[model samples]
Target: MNWRFNICFISFMFLFLLGLSNVFLGIYFCLNNIIYFLEWEIVTLNSMNIIMTLLFDWMSLIFMGFVLFISSMVILYSHNYMEGDVNLVRFILLVLMFVLSMMLLIISPNMISILLGWDGLGLISYLLVIYYQNFKSYSAGMLTVLSNRLGDVAFLLSIAWMLNYGSWNYVFFINFMGNTMESQIIAFLMIFAAMTKSAQIPFSSWLPAAMAAPTPVSALVHSSTLVTAGVYLMIRFNVLIMSTDLSKYLLLVGGMTMFMSGVGANFEYDLKKIIALSTLSQLGLMMSILSMGLPNLAFFHLLTHALFKALLFMCAGVIIHNMLDCQDIRYMGGLVHQLPLTASFFNTSNLALCGFPFLAGFYSKDLILEMCLVSNLNFVSFLFYFVSTGFTACYTARLIYYTMSGDLNMVSCSSVTDESWFMLKGMMGMLFMAVVGGSMLSWVLFPSPLMVCLPFELKTLALSVSVLGAAIGYSMAHTNYNDSLLSMHNILISFFLGSMWFMPYISTRGVYIYPMKIGTNLLKSFDQGWCEGMGGQGMYEALKNFSKTNQSYQNNFLKIYLTFFVLWIILMLLIF
Candidate 1:
């Protein structure tokens, strides 16, 4: 099949066109203050109304536009990324299905429909994460799916919890019954669901593990759709989250998530994983902001982060592609000299991630920092906010130093040029967005600029932290990796921080080991030993012994009977 007619090309064309239209429509809807709730009443029984609802407002429409736009680019990237693979068409289909699930999630306001979309995302993400079809992919996919499945269960529970509210369309009930006990329970469950889906503290290990998928899938999943689902869900229920007491939990978890992931990224050597950790940190930021009752700000950050993060992943893909599947940053150096365009895009996205002024990330991140600075946040939370900011810059600088400026760390004869025209084309769209998408989104998201009045020290705190982080990162970049290991304890510290405080262990081995061992013991003591001896085997042995006694009696039946009769006769004669 030719490029134009092939599935990849066709899907990209279709999604890109649809994205443009939706974006325009979203803008129109926003400007005109229009909200459309398209509901199909599937069934009506007494007080029950089963409705398949589609909510088309500025939020959904714009989110849909972003998702579709990013998806199109990712598919285009995959066109070249998966070129020689035999199952290219299948990969394209899977990607389309993944986007479809995201669209479903974005549009639906009804719990039932939301559950369908929610489960679809979880199931399809599993498929996509395991697309490489290896042991590592299998493990990562399982972790990812199981992690998301927690959210699915939470969604189901929330749906069931809302059953008493007589309508699955939560948009209506949220304002009316938001403070009720049932709504609180449902909201807490939704928060739990969001946490799992978003990879909050305990659920975070899966985000890095999910890097087992293809780069295109990573660019799509991590950047725009799957991980962001929780943030979007919370945004929809922002009213409820703000009103309820659950927001405190969110505050703590989001702060911890931000801090831990930032630390983890600094110690990480894997290029994709460092980016994944950054994604985790951003998710934490969104969650915390949402908890602060600034859902709009949280959403603003989400959109901007999506743009640059997608570009970052695409640039990483180009580098990884050129490196012949080597993903370690330590093994890479002087890439800027060999691949200038890719490096430039990489640097742009990295700087944006660091919240460089006028870039996509700066608008949202700076606002978030100012809000935290001005908000009545506790001391620990305030520390977490600024410290994590420093770590963000630290990791970004370290990553840049490692990949762009160090001595050549690759094979002497290996090629490292960005020769893939299609890959560059895929990145071009996002690169444009990464540069200007922030200001445009900030203007659209906040009709009026948020006013922040702060003293000099407080205002410059974020900048100071970032610069200090950069200096440390640069100095550390020049040091040998082995020299940092002063002792075994330091190694442990590095490992713990690098491994997300050993959360992957907690999520995987820590979670399953005890249960598995207990299960095996249960099988041995009951199913194999005592219960078997008393149940099936014991019953068989008793039956065998009983049958042997019966057989012996049958073999001596006439003699035994005659002897008993003679004894009875003799006894009777004596009595007479």
Candidate 2:
């Protein structure tokens, strides 16, 4: 309570004000179209000026505002969520450190200085992921850390590549040298890094695995902080990435990631994991759209998605908390009856996610989809985009069907209430943002609404897919319909989709199986057979025999001593 009263309360107040001011600054910066880049020379060696640089622009300020505002709400919510935990202070501290790292990253324009925040993020996120102090949390933390380390290596490589240009600040060189071979190489590396952090395909397994963290951290990580870092980086690097051939490949990866994660969520039963997969799906949408050379559109979607998704996670926390920590949707039917307020927030956030007309997700998500339709993408990319959009709606509807409208599945004695003041207050605030954040961001980020000219069919396609997906999702909630689905020949396809193309097997176990088998074989033939025999067991046997022989000799030490005494006397006389 003291920890809550002191650190949580103080941090919540400070961060809220900072976030509000950042929102204002962001709006002003956007209106004025001003970018202020400041550099501080740390040291000089030869011709290279080691410098730390900060970029103050609309994008960074707005992103900071959303990140900080969400983080503050999360911290305030945790006041009630983690009230009984003994390590509440430690949790709050980790969260504060996480926010600080995020701030450093948001402002940093130099690759070298950005690593401080990048590595800090990776380290602190690992600490937070393992915050529950259990084996599952540890294992998930390992996967999360190792996957992120690949991004670290990519960042390091890009940093080294940038060294050839005599400075670490990429902003100076990006616009002019964008089409050059060297810049393309750096863009490739940065794209790789962004993919891992943002949880695009082949690197998406960790997103679901990371659900092992507490809900509050999940709210921050999935919504506005950790997963979005990559998209932010790519947005910064868009000038360079779009000039090269890499954007095409990025488009394919993002589309597939979206389809993959969306299909996976419909198969998931764990409530939190389902939400996590949704986050992954939205991340793919952002990445795919950004890859199309629309960084501004991508940023718009990023901010709008953050608001609703954070509220979505908060509503989930309330449900899970009141249900005595049970996370399975199968155990949580008719929630709207028992916890109407939570259901209201949950359904609203979920609808916003589905891009329900003019809600937070609609303004941005609709624009992105519409922009995609207008672009000359290939049919495969086109299919992936729309199909993924449909699946997004499909999963959203399925979650609502399972949790909000069914018969009560909880125990009779269970007390489900949304009376937690702190948690409710946080949700209320995010709900407001989730409802209006889209229009606000769309207005600020754009001087006027983007006018996309499209045929009636094309313009309405997004809404159409959402409706069709919703119908399919609701049908999925019926057991009889599900059995019919399972009976179909598409069962294997469904299984593959549900298993994330078997990524847990491919990405997680697939990575270690070969090395593990090789290590096992090496242990038998090399360590156990040769090295152990010659180095350990062989030496032990040799030492044991020598000791035994010496012991036998020592048994006769008394007689040998007398013989030595006689021999000594005879030798002494001979020598004299």
Candidate 3:
């Protein structure tokens, strides 16, 4: 009867139903050779039309199962994490809404239904981010909404373009786009939209900002639903993106984003921000692989990343909750002794994240690098993958060092304890998957025939190089380099502090600067010269007198109207 109990009950029921639905659909799709199921019926003249179509293919089922699994974990974790929070009911409601929307997104066979679910997820995520209504959370929520809306605009445009060109369904678009120029354009626009939704490149700032949300929201957004949506979009349009010039562009953008965000992750101090940046970087890697026409590889990485990143974030949450909400890694060190399980889980997840040998991240990330080597864009792709791997190792190592192995002198253990059994169980389950999923995936997803015929030699060499790079990075982090001089006044530090004010000017100089300067001068003139010339406070009085003088003329339009009407009548009579 209590609010929290009610939320728990509802959440459990929803996930249970969703899991059951996925199972039924999967069985139906596989056993009955059913290509499509129409749940809603309609009529057009004498013809019967379907209103809702469900296409349950392998890809949709895989992603749907993942969504359901992760949603269930989040719900269980929230039961403990949000125990005493006043908005627990609202939080659970939003979680259910998000899960339902994601399920709908994966199952929807038409663009209209897909967009409906997509927008619903976005809206609910925004609301969840600002659930507490604090200033910072409000800003985060606004940023999330604004970024997603920009992506939604691209989606709408693409849909309209598709409709105008006579392709209203996913299957038709896939077939049509494979043989047309407009298809490439639409594909490019869709990728652009996906990038924004997944927080890739220029739009990536919003994901880090979204850390203002509760930890459960972070897990949902980063691990399972929101960020993965872009990957899904890429997968949905896999045939189109692969067969067009858009593929080349996707490869380039995705590769660059992977490398760039990897570098950014190295510079972050907040625990959540580090993980958030890593998520973006991993998304980039997945996108790059997808662009290379390897949707299966991308999906594999998506699954692995979800498992480890969720584990890492939840572990970090346990630490934060124990430390009275402190998130800065600078203030956290040597928590292993007090929170052994949290530390262990964090380490395991971080190992998987760094692409260590035989871990989930290793298989997925190595496959991505291998695909890069074999892709047509191999030269550029290899370089991006190499650089990104190095940077990923650096930041991931940094996170581990800062959190678990650092000097404990600065950290206080005033009220620290291990996480609840439920949280620990959830994390351990993910950790188990992170450790073993890679091998299972390598067997299931990688084609054995292709693996044998292709140059396994090159892939082996690539994997060796990636592993070696990670090792070098791990060793570098292990050795404490005493470079106080370098640390005291690094150029990057100076640039970062000063750039806050100067970068805007530099960036705006081309077109923005001129307009901004002109506007500023005009404002100055209005304040200093115009106001003075108009006698400051007496300007209103002068305006009032002028308005009074004009009022009679403005109001008394009867004479002018009559004269014009009479002239018009005379002219008409003369013409007749």
Candidate 2 has an lDDT of 0.89
Which ranges of candidate 3 are over 4 A from the true structure? 1-3, 13-17, 20-34, 42-50, 409-413, 441-488, 493-576
Q: What is the lDDT of residue 31 in candidate 1?
A: 79
Tell me model 3's lDDT, rounded to 2 decimals: 0.76
| TM-score-best of 1 and 2 | 1
lDDT of 2 by residue, 1-576 (tens): 664568888989999999999999989999998999887888999997767789999999989998999999999999999998888888999999998998898999888778988899899999998988999999899889989999999999999998889778778878887578898889999999999999888999988888888999999999888899999999999989988999999998998889888888998889999999999989989988988999999999889988999999999999999889999897778898888888999999999999999899999989988888889988999998899989999989889988887686876568888789999998988999999999888777887768999999999999999999999888876753336655245788778878899987786677766778889999999989999889999999999999998887788788878887999999999999
Model 1: lDDT of residue 100: 92
C-alpha lDDT of residue 186 in model 1: 84
True-vs-predicted CA distance for residue 95, candidate 2, Å: 0.6
Best by TM-score: 1
Write candidate 1's Cα lDDT for 1-576 as tens digits.
Answer: 485337888898999999989988998898788999897889999998777889999999999999999999998888788887888888888889899989998999888778777888899899989898999999999888878888888888888888897788888879777577987898899999999999998999999999999999999998889999999999999898888889989999999999999999988889999999999999999999899999889988999999999999999999988888999998888999999999999999988998988999999999899999889999999988889999999989989988998676877568888888888998999999999999998888777788899999988888788889888877776664546533245887888888899899988887765778999999999899998899999999999999998888789788888988999999999999
Question: How high a TM-score does candidate 3 get?
Answer: 0.82
Pick by TM-score: 1 or 3, better one: 1
Evaluate all candidate structures by whole-model CA lDDT and list the values in order: 0.90, 0.89, 0.76
Each prediction's TM-score against the native?
0.94, 0.90, 0.82
User: Which residue pairs clash within candidate 1?
Assistant: none
TM-score ranking from best candidate downward:
1, 2, 3
Candidate 2: Cα lDDT at 97: 92
Q: Which runs in model 1 stand beyond 4 Å of their true positions?
A: 1-5, 42-50, 480-489, 548-552, 555-576
